[model samples]
Structure formats: C-alpha cells, structure tokens
Target chain A: AQTVTQSQPEMSVQEAETVTLSCTYDTSESDYYLFWYKQPPSRQMILVIRQEAYKQQNATENRFSVNFQKAAKSFSLKISDSQLGDAAMYFCAYGSGAGSYQLTFGKGTKLSVIP
Target chain B: SQTIHQWPATLVQPVGSPLSLECTVEGTSNPNLYWYRQAAGRGLQLLFYSVGIGQISSEVPQNLSASRPQDRQFILSSKKLLLSDSGFYLCAWSSQPNQPQHFGDGTRLSIL
Candidate 1:
C-alpha cells in the first residue's frame, strides 16, 4: 500500500510571491506517478502538475512546478508569482503503473494568498 | 476534447434512503473511471475504480458500491445512506493507468 503525506496543513503567501508545499510518500512500486491537485471552494478538483518516478527532471507547468526527489520519496510543489486565485486546498497523489487506476492522496494543504 | 459529467450537482437524502450518483464521459472510449469521496477540509479518498465495463475494483470497504454499465458510464450506489457518507463525491477519468486523471465538478452529497 502507498501512503502520501502532506506535512503542512496550512500555508499562506503574499500576492506575487512564491510558495512551496511539501509532500512525501511511501511506495514500494518503482514505476509510479505523482500528482498535485488543487481544489477551490467550488469543490472542483483540478490537476496542477504531475511527475513520473522514472523522470529525474522535475515537472513544470507555467507557474506551478514540482521538486521530485525519488530517492528521498519527496515531491514538493512550488507556485511562483502566486495570485489570489491560487488559494485552495492542494493535495498530493500517488499512482502506480501496473494496478488499479485508484490514486492515494495526502490529507492536503490549505493555501491562502494574501493581497 | 474529452469531458466528464456528474450529477446532480447537489443532493440531500435521509438516513437509510437509497442513493445513486451517475458519471459519464464524452469524447473518449475505453477510459478508466474512478469514484472518490472528499470530506470537508480533507484529501480525496478513492472509493472505487473501473478499467472496463463490468470490471469494478474497490479500494476501500465501505457502504458504497460502483458499477460500470457502459464503457463511458459509471455509477456509485448504496443500499442505504449514512451520515458518514456525506461528502463531496468526485468522478474522474484517465486514458491510461499512469496518465493524469481528469475530474468532474463533483457532487455535494448531504446525508441527514
């Protein structure tokens, strides 16, 4: 079984600043995928960024990027030039290559953007 | 241009009442479907997933049950509702096992 952990429960960042949310996971599978999802008050889950375990290079999507350390089992999300719209509950998820399409998610980190 | 739809947007039901939530995908075929429950201020909990029609996998033992009647239609049901079952129900789909999942708007379920 794979378990994801988000140590930071709450995080705040001033507008136009940068913020990093930490995430770690315990998984025995070598081939897997890591994802960051954002949920706003609308309750819609949106994919922020994703990183494959085999890829040594981190994944970046515009202002959102991931610092994936496979050896350390750590995958952290970094949001640059943060805006008020970035305020939401962020979740870290884990999935494997050969198995069910089910994803195990961390408790989540609530991000607050201050103007 | 694949898209997922789930409904009703909001639902309120009494305890012991039967429950059913429907999810459908468009512009895709033979996609993997999933059902997840998100408690308030918490992460998503995977309830069920299906790789194909009539192939449902349960991630957690709970009061919920899922069915895939068609290639693009997935349904979550319960014999009776419970207060613990109250949460936001999300439907997701992916083209492959390791691909990133696309999510629906989610259904807000309130069990009284």
Candidate 2:
C-alpha cells in the first residue's frame, strides 16, 4: 500500500514571504503522480499543483511549485509571494498511473499566511 | 469544461437516520468518480470510486455505501447514520487514470 506523509502539521509565513510544506511517500512503483491540494475555510478542495514522477523538471504553477525528488520519495510544495488567500489546509496526495484512479493522501498541513 | 456538482451544501441528520448525498458530473463521459470524507483537520479519506456506471469500489468498511446508477451520477447513502459519520463529504472526478481530480464545493454532513 502506498502512503503519503506530511511531516509538518502546521506552518506559518508572513505575506509576501515564502513557505514550503514537506511531504514524503512510500511506494514501490516508479511511475506515479503527486499532487498538492488546498482546502480553505469554505471547505472547498482546490488543486494547487501536480507533478509526474517520471519528469525531473518538477512542476510549477504560478506561485506554487514542487520539489519532487523521486529517489528520496520526497515531494514538497513551495509557495512564493504568499498571500492571505494562500492560508488553508494543504494536503499531499499520491496516485498510481496504473489506471487505479485511487489517490492516497497525507494527513495534511495547515498553512497560515500572516498579514 | 467539465464540472462537478454536489447537492445540499450542508446537511444535518440525527443518529440512526437515513442519509443520502448526490454527486453529478457534466461535460464528460466515463470519467472516474470518487467520494471522500474529510474529518476536522485530517486529510481527505477516499470512501468510494467508480470507473463506469454500476461499477463502484469501496475503500473503507463502514455503515456508508455508494451507488452509481448513471454514468455521471454517484450517490452515497447509509441505512442508519452514525455520529462518527459527521464530517465534510467531497465528490471529485478525473478525466483519466492518474489525472488531477477536479472537486466540488463539497457537502458538510453533520450527524447529531
């Protein structure tokens, strides 16, 4: 079974600063996908970014990027120029590209952007 | 242009009462559907997923069950709700395997 681990339960950063959320996963498969989702107080789950394990270039979406180290099994999300809107419960999820369509998620890390 | 809709943004039910939550997707066909339960601060726990109509997969053993009568409609139901079932229920869909899933606003289910 694949399991994702988010070591930091809570993180805080000042507006206009940068923050990184740590994530690691245990999986035997080499080809897979990793995702970061943000859930605000509205309780709406929004996709932040995604990375394919086979790609070493990493994935960047505006202010959000991921440091995907396949060998280390670590996929961390970095938010630059953080805004108040970035405050939310961020989750790291893993998915196998083998047609399972099942996403294993980490516990989550609550991020607070201090204005 | 795909969109997912989850009805009854918020629901409150008494313990032992029957429960129903509906999720439907539009602008796509044969898309994978999933149901997840999010506790207070915990991550989303996948409860059910379907690859096609009438095909459902259960991820956890609980009183809750899921059904997929239509190609794009996924329903979560329970004969008797438990207080433990109180949480935010979310419905999501993906175009293909390992694809990033698009989520609905979600339904907050409170079982008293």
Candidate 3:
C-alpha cells in the first residue's frame, strides 16, 4: 500500500507572496502519479496539478507549480502570487500507474491567504 | 466534456434508518466510479470502487455497500445507518488510470 504524507497541518501567506506546501510519499512502484487537490468551503475537490513519476520535468499551471523530486519521493506545490481564492484545504494524493482507479490521499493542509 | 452528479445535496437520517445515495456520470463510457467518505480535517477514505456494471469492490468492511446498476450509475446503500456514518460522501470518476479524477459537489450525510 502506498501512503502520502503532508507534514504541514496549516500554512499561511500574505497576499501576492508565494507559498509552498510540502508532500512526500512512500511507494515501491516506480511507475506512479502524484496529484495535488484543493478543497474549498464548498467541499469540492479541485485538481491543482499532477506529476508523473517518470517525467523529470515539473508540472506547472499558471501560478501553481509542483517541485517533483522523484528520487526523494517529494512532490510539493508552490503557489505564487497567492490570491484570496487560494484559501482552502490542500491534499496530496497518490495513484498507481497499473490501471488502478484507487487514489490514496494525505491528511491535508489548511492554507490561509492573508490580505 | 464529462461530468459527475451526486445527490441529494444533504441528507439527514436517524440511527438505524435505511440510507441510499446515488451518483451518475454523463458524456463518458466505461468510466471508473468511486465512493469516498471524508471526515473533518482528514482526507478522503475510499469506501468502494467499480470498474463495470454489477462489479463492485469494497475497500473497508462496514455497514455500507455499493452497487452499479448501469454503466455510469453507482449507488451506495446501508441497511442500518450508524452515527459513525455521519460525514461528507463524495463520488468521483476517471476515464482510466493516470488520469485525474473529477468529483461531484458531494452529499453531506448527517446521522442523528
């Protein structure tokens, strides 16, 4: 079984600043995928970004970028120019590449954006 | 575009009551459907997942059970609800592995 760990329980950042949420996973499979999901007060899980274990290049989406260190098994999300809309509970999830539909998720980190 | 629908938006059931929740996906075929229960501050706990109609996989042993009547319709039911079942229930779908899952608005279940 694969496990995802988000060491940070809560993180805060000032408006326009950058914030990074830490995530690490333990998996024996070399082929897998990592994901970051954002859940706002509405409780909808929104896909922030995804990283493939085989791909060395990190993934980025607008202000959201992931520093994926495959060797260290660390995949962290960096939110630049943070906005108020970014306030939510962030989760780190792991998925197998062997055509499995199950996704293991971390406890989650609560992000607060201060104006 | 593919979308997932889960309902009712909120449910209130008394302990030992029967419970049912439905989820459907549109604009996609042969999707992998999943049911998850989320507790406050904790992440999602996968309850059940299905690959095809009439094929359901149970992750945790509990009073809950899941069924797939159609290609895209997934149902979660309980013969006798327990107070521990009070939490947010979410339905999600993915075309296959290595794809990001899309989630519905989710149903909040409260057992009194």
| Top candidate (lDDT) | 3
Query: Candidate 3: lDDT of A22?
Result: 100
- Please report how far candidate 2 places residue B43 from its true position, in Å: 0.8
Backbone clashes (count) for model 2: 0
- Locate the minimum summed-lDDT window of 10 residues in model 3 chain B: B93-102
Cα lDDT, model 3, residue A94: 98
* lDDT tens digits by residue: candidate 1, A1-115: 8899999999999999999999999988899999999998888899999998888999999999999999899999999999999999999999986765778899999999999
Off by over 4 Å in 1: none
Alpha carbon lDDT of residue A33, candidate 1? 94
lDDT of 2 by residue, B1-112 (tens): 8899999999999999999999999999998999999888788899999999999899999999999999999999999999999999999999898999999999999988
By TM-score, the better pick of 1 and 2 is 2
Clashes of 1: 0
Clashing pairs in 2: none
Q: What DockQ do the predictions score, one after another?
A: 0.83, 0.89, 0.85
Tell me the tens digit of each residue's lDDT in model 2 across A1-115. Answer: 9999999999999999999999999999988999999988888889999998889998999999999899999999999999999999999999997867789999999999999
**Top-scoring candidate (TM-score):** 3
